[model samples]
Target: MDLGLRGKVALITGGSKGIGLATAISLSHEGAKLAICARNLEQLEEAAAKITDLTKGEVIFVQADVSSEEDCKRAVEQTFERFGRLDILVNNAGTSAAKPFEQVGTEAWRQDLELKLFGAIHCSSYAIPFMRQAGGGSIVNITTSSAKTPPASSLPTSVSRAAGLALTNAMSKDLAADQIRVNTVCIGLIRSDQIEKSWQRLAPELTWDEFAKDPRHDIPLGRIGNTEEAANVITFLSSEAASYVTGTSINIDGGKGAAL
Candidate 1:
């Protein structure tokens, strides 16, 4: 029953909502001190409050745009300042700028990479040394199934996120010597505010519930996914339970990926 996370420290990016928020609470429940960051102050505050209420573990929030180096640095710096050590890093902050191939341009692609790929890069850059010094740690990147499936609508985001999987795998081998484990969760369609927004942007006519119905039938699980399911799996990997696992990408999509 013990995850051995009691009193340990974790830093989660994009922790204001959805999977990130859920992971924060789950980690807290296992007794990890948490530092979560997002660009929106209000959303971050609300999410932080909810996590604190749910887990009662030490939770702190800071405002940071993951796309910016200064902000990324500041987030990790603030986390270290507050926790005095970093045992886990969850890079869950990402955005997809979708468009038809011809319609997409350099800037859009750049932004997508900045948010999804480079954000992971920057956070990992700062998280590693402390983790090494503190006697190793875990890093979980919440990537998308888009990397595998490439949903027609989500363009550059898919490309960058796919790259993130590569990042996770590659880092796993490199960081293994330091005793730092790196793994990734390849996400499927999850019911969340971001999904709602994506739907509105791609197909404004249908309400979110209506939009969700079509996919539920196609996915073998007979339903989509939620924050809790994703968080639970990540919590397992984040714990000592997955001590031998690293550089592996687990597709938590209820058999949707279908790829070996």
Candidate 2:
């Protein structure tokens, strides 16, 4: 079914790889003009090329670290300047910080919160104007399932993601009058590039398949998720089909989270 997203403009943060890259490709498949940003120019170029190959759609890559307020502003501005208007903003730029509470230093806590929470805040602040200019739009913030059911050693990420969830709910109510819908997608163990790196460093003996199947948690599905799965949900949330979906934090974790 058509998502009615043709010609719409979307800006995705941390779009050079992993879930962000997957979302960019998914949006492009729906015929949306894309502006993807990341800190590394080389990776951005590679992702842009892959997106073009997949969707044959218009895609631009900008070098920007979402943790910096200035970079966030510039990224949004450049997107509007290139596309003329923004219809969707996917705040997916973040990392997984899962150190023990006692082990997490003050600097680590500050860095994680700065990158995950403030990144979305800064991007949404700048993108709202363009969305309003376009008459209305959607914002999908990529959080984690830990926000709802945080486990031991889930510090920094869980705390920051909880704040992100609150942000989503609050903005959904506040921005309703402007026709700007805000929502979040909570993730589980997905097969991202970052996960691949972790496997290489921590379990080099195991192959990708073996690594994903290693019973780390009692995931009901008995396996990890994929980038495309998460991206599909995000793309749906950003589309007209999800017009009524706001302030809700949906888990794409295959029933791994205990929260109802």
Decoy 2 TM-score against native: 0.96
Identify the leading candidate in terms of lDDT.
2
Residue pairs with colliding backbones in model 1 are: none
Q: Over the stretch 1-260, how does candidate 2's per-residue lDDT look in tens digits? A: 88989999999999999999999999999999999999999999999999999899999988999889999999999999998999999999998889789999999998998899999999999999999999999999999999998899999899999999999999999999999999999999899877889899989999888888878857888878899999999999999999888999889888898885
In candidate 1, how many Å is residue 202 off? 9.7
CA lDDT for candidate 2: 0.94
For candidate 1, give the lDDT.
Answer: 0.88
TM-score top scorer: 2
lDDT of 1 by residue, 171-255 (tens): 9999999999999999887878877776788778977667766664488876667889999989988989889999998888777
Off by over 4 Å in 1: 197-217
Q: Each model's number of backbone clashes?
A: 0, 0
- What residue runs in model 2 are displaced by over 4 Å at the alpha carbon? 201-203
